[model samples]
Structure formats: C-alpha cells, structure tokens
Target: MQLEIISRLPSTKSTKPPILCIHGAYNRAWCWDKYFLPYFAQAGYPAYALSLRGHGNSAGANRLYWASLADYVHDVAQVSQNLAQPPILIGHSMGGMIVQKYWEAHHSHPAAILMASVPPCGLWSPSIYLACQDPELLWQLNLIQFFGLRFVTPSLLKKALFSEPTTAEIIQNYLAQLQPESQRVILDMLWLDLPTLHSQPTSPLLVLGAANDKVFPQFLVNWTAKIYDTQAHIFPNMAHTMMLEPAWQKVADYILSWLQERKL
Candidate 1:
C-alpha cells in the first residue's frame, strides 16, 4: 500500500509556510481541492494533501481494515516530523480527527483547522441524528450502505451529508474521487475511540462549522471547541460540505487569517 501524497510546496523562498490538508472519512484527498491546497499555496503557505492507504491512488494495503486509523495518524506524524517547519495542519471531517490524534501523540507547534468536519467529539451520537434535521436519514443510512443497488453513489452520500449548500456538480465531482473502503474504515474509528482522542491537548485550534450542514451538527462543532477551550466560527450559509460551500474561499481566508493571527 503506497501512500499517494499530493505535495505542493511554494516556488519562492518568501512563500515558506507549509500546510498539510487532510480529508474526511469515506473521502479521498481531492476533497481539499475546492479550498485548502490551492488557497493555502496562494496564501504563502505550501500545502500537501495525502490519500491515506486504501484511499484514492494510495489503496491496496491489507493494513487498512478499519484498524488503519492509527496508521493514518502516523501518516501525518511522518510528514509533521520531516517538515522543515511545523506545517499548518488542516483537516476536514475524519482528517480533522486524525490531526487531533497526531497532536496528542506529538505535542508540537503545528496549528490546526477543522472545517465543517470532525471536532473533538466525533459524529455518531443520537444528538447528531437529531441535528441531521432529517427524520428518515438514519433509516436511509443503513439502506444506502447495504440495500441500495448504488451503494457507493456519491449523490446519496452528498444528499445525506450536504444540506443543499453545495452544488450538485461539486458533489458529483467529489463522489467520483472517493475510495469507498477507506471512508468506511475511518468512520468506524470515529465511533469507537473518539472520546479518548478528544481528551488530548490541541494547539491554536479553529473549529469552522456550517450551520446548514446535515452530517456534523453545528452544536457538536461549537461544543467540541469550547470543551477544548478553543475558538469557533460558524457559517450560516455553508452546508455540511464546508469545503464545497459556494463561498468556500471564505473558509480559506479565515484559516489563513487564523494562521496569521497566531504568528502575531
């Protein structure tokens, strides 16, 4: 199982900050394309997005059997340790959770941003089902994963996760990028040991939430940050797919600003 890293560094010495973007469960590294990688690169921060083992072009590892979450964390660890400077670690959904685990294991100066993704508390609680604001969503979840002929349909996952704040084309594009089993494995990790991961200390954390998101509830994002004594910013116009939100560039701005503030 070879790791496929979309490593992008700045061309000029002046653009020296490095950022590592990690995507969520059931998703490939391309999820960051709508925002993180390119935006951060333009912000004078070089960025890298890696397709975890069993994900995207990185699949083919037997080690990815849902137990690979730790391996995913180590992926970040390896990059973080080897980088000349501690990179700004930004994760969406499962990627955010992995960043947390990495910080817990390393305790370094790397900053982190969680955008409409996972928080200190991983999704799966009854509250999230309620926050989904869709009464029949839970029922549909099981049906899609098992019964539906189009089990891996991006349209369905997009509908379950996004609240119409993202465009159909964007959803379709992202769906095309997914490597299914990798997505399943990471979600399973969130369900099992999320609380322990949440207990770990984090650096200047930014919890970005989409008020309209159907998957990760706004309350969970807010609460997760506060519980860890960090700050959060909510976007009423965004959906669960914060990276694909119409004004996804706004997310990039906020993150770059946060990184700047930390430097100040």
Candidate 2:
C-alpha cells in the first residue's frame, strides 16, 4: 500500500528522527495540525503527516473497501522505520489502534502517542449490541452505513469529539474530511492485550487525552497509560483532535518535554 507523506522540515536536520503523525480512521493526513506542521518545523524537528492507504492524500478510492487496521501499520512502518533516529510515532482514533498493533507485532518503537482511540474489540460494544437486537433494526442500521460507516450522530455527540475548538467552522472542516465505508471486516480485527503491548515498549509512551472527550474518554486514556506503567495527561480546553485544537502548541510542548526527559 502506498502512503501519502507530506513533510514540513525544520531549518536543519539533526541526527534524530522527525516527529511522524498518523491521523484517525475516516480522516486524511492534513487533519493533523492547522498549526502543528509549521510550529514543529520551526521548533527544529522535521515534521511529517501520513495518509494511510485509502485516506487523505493517498491513492485508493476504495475509501470504502480497500484498507485494513494493519494497512495503517504499514503506513507508519514506511515513515518511521527510516528515521535518522526513531521518529516519535503519534496516532489518533483508529490510527492509535494501528500504532498499538504495529508495536505489538514489530520491533519499531518511536515513542508512541495515542489520542481519542477506540478500545480494540469494541465490535461488541453496547451500542453495537443494542443496534443488533432486532433484525429489521439491524437492516436499517446497515443501510445507513456504507461498509462500516455509522449513521451521522447529533451535534451533541460531535461536541464529545472535542471540547475546545467547537466552532462551526472547525466542525465543518472536519466533516469535509470524513470518509465512509461499509467495510466491517476491519472492526473484527483483534488487538493484542493492551497490558502486554505496553509491557514490551522500549521507550516512554505518552497518552494524551482531552479533558472533555467522550469518544475515548479520560478514564480509558488513564487506564491505557496506567497499564503501560508510564504517564498520561489531559489537555485543558482540548478535544479528540488535540493536534488541531486552539491549544495544540500546548500538546506539542508536552510531547517535546516527554521526549526530552526520556531522550527518545
């Protein structure tokens, strides 16, 4: 699978791997930073954003049928494996799942960052369970979805995706980047035990969460960090899209500090 990679480099290259960002499912690479690319580049680290197989700037139109959870691992693999030093591998939502799965199966460790990620094996989620109780209801649900696409939720639900930067413009911008698919196969992809994955990490891992995000929620984020025996922090006035929020610089600063403290 071809990855669509865009780079914004710092004025100089050092012997370290630049920060590499991975966007969540149904989103393109540019979803990373309205301010992130230039800010990090200016801060002296080469910055990169990847469009996994069918999303964003990458080439498949199967936006409906052509990608998998592992395909995203391949995307991250391509970008981070070649770093001068291991690049800080950051992922959001489904992208977070990808990073976790990759680390579980491979030797790459670029100090992962996961944001608003879904719990693996949530195909049995209560919401999914309830939706499947009635045969006719299930059929209705399937129609609204493409591959695995869910029906658009109300704004109240959207509010949960972010706490800060809830402006109409920001919402519209994200909506424009949304991709839909009826591909449920990816949802069944089993992830390794989080505790086990965390145990094997060779570098410091940061689990950044939005104080107000409900999609992945604070408790889950904290749980993920705690299991890893590392650190977790909340972004004040931030959302699931921490990398794009008004206080994105604050998140980046945290990332820099985490790396500095651990020397990753």
- Give, for candidate 1, the lowest lDDT window spanning 10 residues: 179-188
Error of 2 at 256 (Å): 1.3
lDDT (C-alpha, whole model) for all candidates: 0.69, 0.66
Q: What is the model-wide C-alpha lDDT for candidate 2?
A: 0.66
| Per-residue alpha-carbon lDDT of candidate 2 for residues 32-79, written as tens digits (9 for 90 to 100) | 657777777777778888887777767666653755665567667877
What candidate 1 gets wrong by more than 4 Å, as runs, is: 59-63, 126-128, 144-149, 152-155, 163-165, 182-191, 197-202
Worst lDDT window (10 residues) for model 2?
Answer: 188-197
Predicted candidate 1 versus true structure: per-residue lDDT over 108-147, tens digit per residue? 7567777766655565553356545675666665554445
Tell me each candidate's TM-score.
0.86, 0.81
What does the lDDT read for residue 193 in candidate 1?
A: 51
Note the residue pairs that clash in candidate 2: 146-182, 147-181, 147-182, 147-183, 148-181, 148-182, 148-183
